[model samples]
Target chain A: MAKLSRRRFLTETSAAIATAPFISTSATRARAQESRKLGFAICGLGRLSESQIAPALARTRHCRLAGLVTGTPAKAEAYMAKYGVPAGSVYSYDTMHRMADDPGIDVVYVATPNALHAEHATRAAAAGKHVFCEKPLEVSVERCRQMIDACKDAGRLLGTAYRCQYDPHHLECIRLVREQVFGAPFIIEAGFGIDVGGPDQWRLKRDLAGGGALMDVGIYALQATRYLTGEEPVVVSALETKTDPAKFAEVDESMVWTTRFPGGVVAHCSTSYKAGGIQNMRVNAERGWFELDPAFFYNGNHGRRSDGQEIRFPEIDLFAAEMDDFAQCILEGRPSKVPGEEGLRDVRIMQAIYESARTGAAVPLA
Target chain B: MAKLSRRRFLTETSAAIATAPFISTSATRARAQESRKLGFAICGLGRLSESQIAPALARTRHCRLAGLVTGTPAKAEAYMAKYGVPAGSVYSYDTMHRMADDPGIDVVYVATPNALHAEHATRAAAAGKHVFCEKPLEVSVERCRQMIDACKDAGRLLGTAYRCQYDPHHLECIRLVREQVFGAPFIIEAGFGIDVGGPDQWRLKRDLAGGGALMDVGIYALQATRYLTGEEPVVVSALETKTDPAKFAEVDESMVWTTRFPGGVVAHCSTSYKAGGIQNMRVNAERGWFELDPAFFYNGNHGRRSDGQEIRFPEIDLFAAEMDDFAQCILEGRPSKVPGEEGLRDVRIMQAIYESARTGAAVPLA
Candidate 1:
C-alpha cells in the first residue's frame, strides 16, 4: 500500500515543486506544505475503531489520525491520550459542524454502527470533509442515497470502505479471473458465518443492524461475488433459516441465496450467525476451480488454485491499505474505486435478498 | 458388500432349513435349494455394464450373471467370453420377452441410455423378472412412473441402482449427518461435473440423453443432497450456462441449482460437462462441517469432518453391493432400500430443476 502511494507522492511532489513560483508569504507556503498526508477524524470509536482503524491510521503513509468525533468524553480522552490529539480537536457528534473551521481534518472515517452510517457520513460531508464509511453503508437504500447526495451537495468525495478491495489476496484472485487464468468464472460459492453473541447484542436488533448475519458478514460474500465477477446480479432467490426463532426474532440467523448475473455467471452464497468456521469462497470456471478457505477475515487469508498454485502475496495491514487508498483518492481529487454508489449497490442487492427471503420467492433486479 | 450378505445368507439358509419339512418333491426342492444367488440378465452391454456392473457381479455373493440382453452380437460375444453364459440365454432387445420361459434369470439390470430405461424396465418386469435399473431411472417423470407401475402390476420388485447408496464413503458421511456427529445438518453444497464427450456422443443428443452434465454427472450431486439430508426439496431455482452454444444446443453444458428442504435445510448444487474433476459434497451443520472430496466417482471417495475426524470406511464394489441388496430384497420378498419410489423422487427433482432452468425461475414441487 505504501510503496505505490509513495511513488505517486514523489511524482506529485515534483509537480508541486515545479509550480512553486507564486509570490505568497513563505510562512503560509511552509504551512501549506507541512504535511502531504491527509488528516482524518474518526467518527464513532466503537469496537472497529478501537481494534482496527485507530491503529491502522498510525501505519498509513498517506493518512493520519487528526481528530475524534464521539458523544463520550471518556472515549475522547483515551483516544486523545493515546493518539496525541489536541483537546480542541476532540468534539461531540452534535458539535461536529464546528469541524468546518478546523483545517486539520481533511476526511471523516465513519466507524459507527450500521444504522448510523448515513447520519455520520452526511454530517461529515456537511462539515466540508470527505467521508469514508463502513460496509452495508446503511440499513436502507434510501438512507444510502441520502449519504451519497449529501456528499454531492457539499462538493466532498464519498468513499465506501470495502476492505477486501484493497487486500492483496483478493486482488490477486480477481486479477487471475479477469486475466482468464482460470477461464471465465461461471459459478462462485461464497459464504461467511460466525456464531455471534447473545441476544442482547446490537447486531440482534433489526432497527440497529439491518439484518443480522447477512448484513454483518454475509455482505462480505455478496461483495466478493460482485467484485470477483465484475458484474451485478440480475436476479436472486434466497432462503432464510433460524435454529433459534426467539433469539433471532428481529433478524435472520442463517441465509442461503442464489443469483444469476447478466453474463451467464451464477452464484450460490450463504451467511449465518449460528455456525462458525464456515467462511470460504470458491470459483468454478471453464478449466478448473480456485478457492479461499476462510476467505474473509481481518487476520489473514489463503487462496489457491485447483492445480495447486497458491495466490501468494504479502499480508499488509488491510485497514491501513483501504484508508490510505481513500486518502490518496482525496489527495488526487478523484473518485474512489469504491465510491458511495458501490456501497449503495450492495445495499440494494441485500434488500433484494431480504425481500426474496421474506416473500419466499425470487426477486428480480432492474 | 459380501460380509453383511454372508451373515444374512447364513441366517436365511437356516430359516430355509427350518421350513424344509413341507417339501413335496426332492428334485423340485433340490433345484430351489441349488443356488440362493439371484441370476441377473444385463439388459445393455454399455460402458457402465462392461466396466463396472459386469465386473461387480463377479464380486457379489448373492447375484450372478445368467443372461445377456442386447442387439449388438459383438458385445454379447465378448461379454460371454469373459463371463460364462450359455448361447441360448443371449437375447436381443425385442426378444427379451423369451426370458419369461427361462427361470434361471431372476432379475434384469437395465444399463441402457437415459431415454430407454422405461421400455427395458417394463419389459423385464413383464417377463416375470425383477428390474434393477441404472441411475436417472428415465428421462421423464412419466416414464419413471411407468416403470414403477409396470413392476407393481407384475408383482416384481423394481429397484434403482443408486450406487452411492451402497458406497461406503457416502454411507459413512450420511451416517455422520444422521447421528448429528456434526450437529443437525442445515446446509449442503454438492456438485459433480466431468468434461463429457464431444457432440457425437449420446450424452450430447437430446433424444438419447435427457441432459448433459445434469443427467450424466450432475444427478450424483442432486442425489447426494437428497440422501445426505433424507429430505425432498420443496422448491428449486436453477441456471444453465453453455460455453459453446452450437455444441450444447441440444443439452445443458453446465447447470447450477439451489433448493430448500422441508426442515429449513437448503442445498447449493452444480453440474457441468465442460469442467473436469469438480465433484465434491460438503454439509454444514449447527456445530461444524463435513465433506466428501471427489464425492461421486466410480474410483474412490474421501470424507472428513471439520472437527478432524475421518468418516472412514472400507472401499467396496458399490455396484456389487447395490445388486446384492436388490437380489436379497427379491429373495426376502421385500422392496430394495433404494426402490422405484426413491428413483422417482430424484427424477421429479431433476425435472423441476430443468424446468426452472428453462423458465429462469423457481419451480415448486407438490
Candidate 2:
C-alpha cells in the first residue's frame, strides 16, 4: 500500500473538471447558438434556492437565473434586485403558469417543500418548461408518477436534483463498482443526517415533509445504495425511533432500514434529525472495500479504498454541476442520467420502507 | 478541532498502560508468590488458539501457557515442542478431564468450535479451573446458561474472550458514551465481516459454527452496539441474503438486522462471510457523534469524534491485555467485566435476530 497525498491524488484525477470533448462541444454549441444560456426560473425562494441554487446558476456554464416565482413579494423583490432580473420575470406561485407565454424561462427548478414538488413540477411542465425538481421528487410514489407523466405529456424533460449524480467522487465510486474494480459489492452502508432545528419547521409536518428524516436525509442513503449496487432492492425492512415525541409528534425523528438487493447485496441505512452529523457511504465487495465520508456534501468529500488507494477528486460546485448536466442533456436532446424515472424508483423503495416500518414486517418491492 | 498528532495523543492518553498502583501490585504479588505465573490451558489447537492465544499467553505477565488439549495428537506434539511444554501437560480432548488431578493449570481457555464451547467449558469448570471461553459463550442460550451454572457450582470465574473490552480505544469509546460526553446515543451502526474461504471450513458448517457470519463476526457488531449504547435491544428485525446458494447452502452468506433499544435508540447492523473487510462502529448521539473504524482489529484501530478530536490510543497486544485482565480479576477475587452474562446477552440478541430473519418479522426480546 502506497500513501498518496490528497492534493496529488486530486490533481492526478482532475477532480470535477469536465473532459476535453465536453468542453469543446459546449464551446462549439455556444458559438453556433450565439452563446445562448438556458434560462432557469427558480420556484420557491427559500433558503436553498436563495443561497445555493441561485448562486449555482450563476456558476453554471449554460444556465442563467432568468426569473423567480415566490409567494413572498419581499423575497421576489430582493432576488430581482440582487440578480438584476426584470420586473416582468417575477411571478407569484399562482401566476407561475403564465410563464408559458414568456420565452425567457426554459426550465423551472422546483425547490419547494416536499408536498409541493408534484404540484409545482406538474404546473411547470404544463407551462412549457422542463422541470428540475429537488429530491424526494414528490411526497408519494403516486405523485412522482404524476409528475413524470406530466413532463412526458408536455414534451418536457424532468430531471431530479440528485446533485451527487454529477459529483466527481461519487461518479468514481459508481464507475468502480460498475467495473467491479474490487469485485462484486456484497454489502453497502450509507447514511445522512443533520441536527434539525425546530418543531414548527415545514420538515416536521407530515403533510409538508411527507415523513421525517427518511424523507429528508435518508434519500441520500437510498440513492447511494441503489447506484452502488446497480440493482433494485427486492425487499425492505425498517424501524422508526422518536426520542422527543412532542418535538416529532407527526413524523419520525430517526429511522433505520435494511434492504436486500438482487445479488445478495444488503444495505443497512439510517437517518435521524435528533442525532448528530453523519454523511458517509461504504461498499464492501468480494475482494475489497471503498468508502466516502461526508459523501454527499457540496465539497470536502474524501474517499479511500482497501488497497490503500485514495479517491481525491477535486471539489466542484455540486449544484452548479447538477444544473449544468441537466442543461447539457437538454442541449444534446437526450434524457438525464438522473431522470424522473430514477427519482420514481427511489420513491417506490421509500414507500416500501415506510410500509415496512408501519407494519413492522418486511415489505416486498415491485 | 485542534489537530493532535497520533504520537502526542497516545502519550497524553497513556493508551492501555495501567496506572502505578496496578503495576506495583502485580510486581509485589509476583514477588510474594515467588514469580509463579498463573497457568492457562487452551482447549483447542485450531488456528486462533495456535496463532493468537498461545502467543498472547507468552506475552502476558500474569499468565503462562501451561497445558494444551487437542483431539489431534500431531497438533498436541507440535504445540508441546514449540512451547517446550512437558508431555505430561498435554492431553487429548477425551482425556482432558484428567487435568483435574494436575495443579499447574489454573484456567482453561476454550477456543473450540461454537458447538463444543459449553461441553469444554463445563468440563473444565468441573475440573475446578476457571473458564475463559471465546465469544458467543456457546451455540445456544441454554448452553451458555449451563456453562455459567457449572462455573458457579465449582466456584470458578467464567470470562468471555471479548478482547475489545480491554482495548484502550474501545474503552475510551465506552467511557464517552457511558459518561454522555456526546449526550445519549440515538443511533448506532455496527458491522463486522470478512471474506471467508471454502465451504468445507468449520465456520460455514451450521452444526459446528451454529450459524454463519452472525455466529462468527456478526457477534462483534452485536456486542459493540450493546456496549456503546449501554442498553439491551427490546426488539429485533432481520433479513438474510444468500447470493451463492451452492456455497452457502447451510447458512446465510449475508445478513442485515435492526434493533430497537430502550429510550428510542435504534441500531442497524450487518455481517457477511462473502463480503469484503469491514469492522466499524458508529454512534450518533444528541449532541454529536463518534466512530471507530477497523475497530475490532488487534491493532491499527483508530477513532474520531464529532468535535474533530482524534482518539489516537497506542497499539497494545489486545489478546495479552485481555488475558492479563482476566488473570488480574482472578488474582484480585473480582469478577470479569466481560462475564458469562455479558456473552449471554449478546447470544440472546443474536437468537432474536435469527428468529426475525427466519420469520421475516420483528421479534421481541424478553
Q: What is the lDDT of candidate 2?
A: 0.82
lDDT of each: 0.83, 0.82
Candidate 2 residue lDDT tens string, A1-366: 122243233222321221223324555654523445677899998889988999999898877787898888889888777776667879888998998776667789999999999999988988888899999898888999999999999888899999988888998999999999988877788988887887779999999889888888899999999988888988899988876889989887889899888777888998888865778898888788899988877789889999999999778999999998898777666679999999989888988888988887789885
Error of 1 at A217 (Å): 1.4
Question: What's the CA error at residue A95 for candidate 2, in Å?
Answer: 1.1
Judge the docking of candidate 1 as incorrect, acceptable, medium or high.
Answer: medium
Q: List the residue pairs that clash in candidate 2.
A: A15-A314
TM-score of chain B of 2: 0.90
- For model 1, how does the per-residue alpha-carbon lDDT over A121-227 read when each residue is reduced to its tens digit? 88888988889998889999999999999999987888988998988888888987899887887778899999887778788999888889999999999999999
CA lDDT of A42 in candidate 1?
Answer: 93
The alpha-carbon deviation from the true structure for residue B359 of candidate 2, after best TM-score superposition, in angstroms, is 2.9
Error of 1 at B329 (Å): 1.4
Q: Mind sharing the TM-score for model 2?
A: 0.88
